[model samples]
Target: MTTDYNQIANQYKKAKEQPWRTRTELYSMMNLIGDLTGKSVIDVACGEGWLTRELRKAGASEVVGVDISEEMIELARRQEAREPLGIEYRVEDARATESAQQFDISVSNWLLVYAHDREELGVMCRGLANRIKPGGRFVTLITNPALYTWQSHPPDYRKYGIEAQLPESAYEGAPVALTVHLEDQSIVIENYYMPIDAHESALRDAGFRDVAFHNMTLAPDPQVGDEGDYWDHWLKYPFFIMIDGIKA
Candidate 1:
C-alpha cells in the first residue's frame, strides 16, 4: 500500500490549502523555477516544509527538505521552530537521497508519482539526478500519464478540491486514488501510474537533459472567478504534469 504519509500528516498539511494548489500546482512549479536568487535547493517530497519554505523565500542560497515521513519531518520541524526560514528538514528517501552537495534546484512536488515500476522509475530518476549539479534543475509534479485516457468520463476534480480514482484498466503500476478535499476531512493519496515513455525513459536514463512536459498555468492575477472561467475545467484537463529537467 505504501501510502502512510505518517497517518496523513495533518491531512496532508491541510490539503495544501487546495485552490488547485495556488491556482495550479504552485503556479506551474513557480513558473518552472525561474529564479532562486543564489540557488541551491533540494526539496524532494518535502511534504510539510511548504515548498521548503518557498525555497528559502525564493532566495535559496541553500535549502533542504527531504521526507520519508517521520511524521512529515515532524511537521517540517515544527515549521522550523515556528518560523526561522533556515530550512533543513529530512527523513530522507527520495530513493535513498545521498546529497554530498550538489544542488542548484531539484524540487519534487509529487515525488515522481511514487514510482512503482519502470525500475522504480529508474530509481526515482536516479534520485532526482543525484540532487542535481551539472547544469542543475529538475522541477517535477507528474501524474498525467494521459490520465489513462480518461477512462470513460472522469473529468470532475471536485471543483479543484481534488479527486482522482482511476484504474479500471490502465496499467503500468496502476493504483491511483489521490483525493484531497479538506475542510473537515478527506485525504487519500496513493499514487502510481508511470508511462509517458516511462517518464522520458526515466529522465534520459537518469542523467536528464532538456526533458519537458508542462501544461497547467493560470494565476496571472487569478484569485478565481468567472473571469478566469473558473479555471475552465482545470485548464482543459490537467490533473497534474509539469516535469522539467536539466541536470546532465
Candidate 2:
C-alpha cells in the first residue's frame, strides 16, 4: 500500500522525536556524512525538514529539501518561516527529482524503500545520482535488507519505539509494514524490502561507486540510560541501516 504521508505528516513529524531516531538513526547517518562546511546539499524524501535544517546548520552553503507530500513541505516551510534558516523546500517525487543545481552531497532518510520493484528503485537512484556532482557523496537510511531474512520472525522493536513485521512468505520487493510509536500515538509507514546486493547494484548502475552499508551504532546519551544493555539487540540487528556511496 502506498502511504499517504500527506495525511500523516503531523504524526510522522512527531515520530522524529522518538529517542531511537536521534540516539541511533540520525547519529549513524550524520557520522557517515562527515563534514558539510560550505558544501551544497539536497535532501530527497526530506519530509518535515528536520534533517534538512540540520544540514543547513552544519554549515552547508545551500540546502534544498524535497518531499512528495505537499503537507510535509508545508510543515517544513512553516518551520523555516519561524527560524529563517535560508533553506528551500519543494514538493517533488524522488523518482522524478531534478535539482536545478547539482549538489555536493545528497541525503535521504528513507527514500529508496518506497520503490516497489527494481525498476522503480533504479529510477530513484539515477535521480539522486544526477542531482549530485561527480565525486560528490550520497547517504541514506533504508530498511535493513540484512534483517529481512536474518531472523525467522520480524523483530519487535517497541523498546526503541518502532515495530516492523515481515511476512511469513517474504520475497524480493515484498511490502513491509513499520509502525512508529510516539508517546501518545502511533503511525504506520509502508516500505518495500530489497536485498543488500540489489541496493548496491542499483547504486552502481546509477553512477555510484564504493557503495557501503553501515551498521547502527549508538552514541552515548545520558538521556537513554544504560545504552549498551538497552540497545544490544539494535546494535546486533538494526531495523534500518545507513548506506553511502561516491558518485562516479
Candidate 3:
C-alpha cells in the first residue's frame, strides 16, 4: 500500500507534544556516536526535522534534513524559523538526495523500513553514501525482524476461519493507531514489522563495512513498570535494534 505523506505529516505535527519512545532511542544512539561539533550532517527521511534539530543543538555546523513529504518539510521549516537552529529542511526522496560528496555524517532513523525491496534500499544507501565523503559514517535504526515475527502471531483459521488476520499489535500491547492513508471518510492503517538481519545485509550489500548492531533498551519508569521488570524482560529482549556502519 502507498504511504500517504500528508497523513504522516499531520501525525508529526501533532507528535511534538507526545513522548515518543523512538525519539528517546534516537537520542541515546546520537550520544553513542560521539561529538558532532562542526560536523556536516544529513538526516535522511527526516520527518518534521526533529532529530535534525537535535543534531544542530549538538554542534553540527550544517544540518540538512530531507524527507519525501512536502507538508512535513513545511512544518520543519516553520519550526526552524521559530527556533532559528540553522537547519535546512527539504522535500527530497531518500533514494535521490541532491548533495554530492559533501556531508561528514549521514543518519537515518526508522526510515529504511519504508523501502519495500532490496534494490530500493541499495539506491537509498547509494544516495546517502554519495552525499558523504569517503570514510564517512552511515548510521541507521531499524526494528528487529525476529522480534517482529515473534510478536505477530498467525491467524487461527480453524478457530475463526477468517480470510486474513485483522492487523493488530505486532509489538508488546495492542496495536497503536498509525495513520496511513486518509480518504473523504475513512483512513487506512497497517502494522509495521522488520527483521535485524534484513537491515544488516542490506547495508552490507550497499557497500557499508564494519557494521555493528546495538540493541537499545529504554530505561524503566514508574509509569511503564518496575526497574527489574524492564531489566529482566524488556532489556533482555529489546524491540528496537540500531545498526551503524562506515561508508566504504
Off by over 4 Å in 2: 223-228
- Alpha-carbon error at 125 in model 3, in Å? 1.7
Better of 1 and 2 by TM-score: 2
| lDDT per residue (tens digit) for residues 120-191 in model 1 | 889888977888999888888887877778643457878778878887777888889888888887878889
Worst 10 residues of 2 by lDDT: 146-155
What residue pairs clash in candidate 3, if any at all? 145-194, 145-195, 145-196
TM-score of each: 0.33, 0.96, 0.76
Window of ten residues with lowest summed lDDT in model 3: 155-164
lDDT of 2: 0.88
Give each model's clash number.
0, 0, 3
Return whichever of 1 and 2 wins on lDDT.
Answer: 2
Candidate structures ordered by TM-score, highest first: 2, 3, 1
Residues 1-248, candidate 2, lDDT per residue (tens digit)? 89999899999999888778888888887888989999999999999998999889888999999998999999999999999999999988788746677999999889999888888889999999989999999999898876656653676687888888777776788989998888887888899988888899999999999999888887787765664477777777778888899998
